[model samples]
Target: MAFRRKNWMAGMLLATTFVVAPLANAADRVKFILDWAYQSQHSMFTIPADDGTYAELDLNVQVDRGAGSGDTVAKVASGAYEMGVADFYSMLRFNSQNPDNKLMAVMAVDDRSALAVASLSATGIKTPAELKGKTIASPAGDASRQLFPLFAQANNIDESSISWNNISIELREPILRRGDADAITGHLTTISMAIDAIGMKRDDIQFMAYSDYGVELVGHVVVARPEYVQSNPDVVRRFLRGAVHGYKKMVADPQLAVASIRKRDPMANADIELARLKMSLDYRMLTPNVQKNGISSVSPERIQRSIDQVGPVFGVDPSTKAADIYTTEYLPDRAELQLPPTGPASSTP
Candidate 1:
């Protein structure tokens, strides 16, 4: 009887060990870097994290803030990180310059470019035509700054007539508010930061959206090294699954999404980030095209148009293949890509 009991105990101990070991090692480690600092605009990544969406998908992920879209692409290609959210045009330029070190966009977030010229109403600089003879401030590395020449060509605004002040991101809005700059070029989303961070009023500002002014550029996209995507296709799909889930929840309750961002960066202002996220969703993310075609997908004609517009600006040869910039091979099914209805609560912001 004693020998039988001892054998049973040993069997139970081995069974417990097997169960606990697999649980300990189940999650796959993945790292994602964002295009810029942790702000409301990045809530799509953070909300999923706060809600355990990534963990549910068996991914152990770390989300880090970045310096710029260009810097984010370099880090991903250098193998410092597995994935990044960056301006698709920047990725196109990078791939054009270094075909050997290629990266491809898996999912596009902002279907329409947020690049714009912003100014205080006091300056009375509302139209792109008004930009001539005005001193404009922008960071040397800003996407808007790099693409301003193209915006100028499209609007027929004289680039040489405008004096440029290469200001830092922290000071871009402040300098404009102080009358040191007659205008600034940045994303439309920057309007929220100007209001929240610098205490400027909403009605006191005006923006000339590049999309409205004939520069039909695309905005942020999820990019990974070609080798990484080839090796880890399932990982890419799973990450997108989590992303779609988070974004749906965000549309339903933006306050909840902003709360998640605050958890990640406790220093963030909840009201401000919430406002930024709403503006991005309205002006940058959910365009008429995205609503009709669905999220995470772009019309081939629009993509080609973007390629044509941006290729020459970045010095990418006309011969450079547009197919090298993006791919849909790893996207989740269309059913899962549909966003929830944009409720009145979300529209309030």
Candidate 2:
């Protein structure tokens, strides 16, 4: 995982010249793959398209939307893209299936999981407890779907009583709207899009966000293959630097981010920006442990603890290398984290 130290030293000199030389425009053509299609939270990766931010780091990134999270990891391991974003647990599950396909997490976009049960306001379903005996529209084989049983237990809802309707997005909206299903297993971002699509304001819907119910879990991350990081540490560092700035700007003004997303994809769910931004902020996705320490800081203990919790279920060796799964080297330093001072904190709809 070594690189030419001399080149890195020169890069440091370039950093010193930032204010004086007015950091020249980025000159590298970098490509990153997304775990799924684009949406609001992707502001970190899309800010280059939103504004002229990438030029400063001598980086130009092309974003590709496709490939499931599991497949995305394989592509990165194969050096198919400079970076890819995928669910945090996908790596664990992937390792369970094939240990050699190791990919590394760089920056986690979310501090905790946002999975939840969403329902229409017309139904008077205000909490997860109300979801008992209701039909739940779920995507078959979804990790969250499988985890729903445990979450249901956590909420004291009888998992057996809740009917499961294997469904897709197109049908989910209609099912809830038509009263076929009382609620759907959804992330806050999805609920944001759902309400907006129904031409109804959020005030008209009653949703139970999982984080509020004490079901917070880790989420997807900006990732790459360990080999890629070894080959191009500077590239990773520059990209994350710019991305962290993008997220800071996003948390600061999600309305602006909505415009940014719309600029890239006309139909991209811009409405989700408000919910995404609010949820991320309230739950400390951007600011989590930032005030106490720093963003992107993962202790070896924290990593090891999480490994121990899931290793048994996934069949990973208990002592599997925690350091191999992620690296904080490419992340920005204290000054660069630069999370905008917290404004008013609020909950997600």
Q: Candidate 2 — which residues are off by over 4 angstroms? A: 1-26, 49-52, 67-71, 121-130, 156-158, 253-256, 268-294, 297-317, 320-322
TM-score of each: 0.91, 0.78
| Candidate 1 local lDDT, 145-234, one digit each (tens) | 889988899989998999999988888888888889998888788755765677788788887878788888888999999899989999
- Give candidates' CA RMSD values in order: 2.7, 8.5
lDDT against the true structure, each candidate:
0.82, 0.71
lDDT of 1: 0.82
Report how far off residue 80 is in candidate 2 (Å).
Answer: 2.2
> How close to the true structure is residue 82 of candidate 1, measured as C-alpha lDDT?
94
What TM-score does candidate 2 get on C-alpha atoms?
Answer: 0.78
State the lDDT of candidate 2 residue by residue for 1-349, as single tens digits: 1477888888999878885563454377778888766666677778765577777787878887755676777777677787888876677667667667677788877666666777878888987788888888867655567557556766899878988999875677667777887777766666656667777677766767665675545667888877778888888898888888887777777887777767767876554666665655665465446544545655656666656655665677776766878677788887777565675444554
